[model samples]
Target: MTAKWREREKTGIRMGRRRRMDMILFNMVREELRGRVRRLKPDWNQLFDRANANKSDRWRCW
Candidate 1:
């Protein structure tokens, strides 16, 4: 099987027609977010720290 199929199997992500379209839109938004982050050119370590902190807070809320 292809790598994409392998990844889907590992993640248990079964995408139907509607989900496929949603994924396409999600990817477009992700690309836009990446572009904006690249343009800012912030410190990588600082970004990592912030992300980690946010993730911790998110888990706490759960």
Candidate 2:
């Protein structure tokens, strides 16, 4: 492969990997938040309550 084309190919591969990683993390977060939605206390505000919780989502809510 020519040096310039090799560099472009590497860049494309890196970008594709990063995008896939981002999509996976985003989906995991979405499903976790869905669990929270089902069990959230009525008195708490969504943003504040999620932020102030002492445990991680997996531990406490999700």
Candidate 3:
């Protein structure tokens, strides 16, 4: 599974997808930015915080 994931990443398969490809990357970038804006940042679980926050903030326009 690790090799497959690495291959997929190298092949750009995720990026080659339709709307979801962009959305996934956009969400990742947004999460990264949000984490950076805060002080006394999270230790190793920042992605968890971002994922949790992403789940609750689903907007109607989205």
Candidate 4:
């Protein structure tokens, strides 16, 4: 009923909205990163295999 109480209520509503927006944005970014990692998993595995193979070849040469 008072001015101070109204201002506090408004601020609380704004904070809640901002929190929801942050959560949505975070989820969007997380999903994007997950998709990217999924797409790159095969490439990452291939590179890992190649590195191991190259290391073995180097040891053989030594």
Clashes of each: 0, 0, 0, 0
Error of 1 at 9 (Å): 26
**Pick by lDDT: which candidate is best?**
3
True lDDT of residue 33, candidate 1: 65
Q: Write the per-residue lDDT of candidate 2 for residues 1-62, one digit (tens) a residue.
A: 57776666567557685465456556756766776776654333564465445543222212
**For model 3, how does the per-residue alpha-carbon lDDT over 1-62 read when each residue is reduced to its tens digit?**
37765565555645554355458757876777687776555343666565456563222113
Model 2 scores what on Cα lDDT? 0.52
Per-residue accuracy of model 1 over 1-62 as CA lDDT, tens digit each:
57765565545434453455456546755665686775765355654454456363222211
Q: Give the TM-score of candidate 3.
A: 0.33
Predictions in order: lDDT: 0.49, 0.52, 0.54, 0.52
Q: What does each candidate score in C-alpha RMSD? A: 9.8, 12.3, 9.1, 21.2
Pairs with steric clashes in candidate 3: none
Clashing pairs in 4: none
For residues 1-62, write the lDDT of model 4, one tens digit per residue.
57775676567557685465456546755666676775754344554454356363222211
TM-score per candidate: 0.34, 0.39, 0.33, 0.38
Error in Å for residue 55 of model 1: 36
Candidate closest to the true structure, highest TM-score: 2
- What local lDDT does model 4 show for residue 38? 54
Whole-model lDDT, model 4: 0.52
For candidate 1, which ten residues in a row score worst on lDDT? 53-62
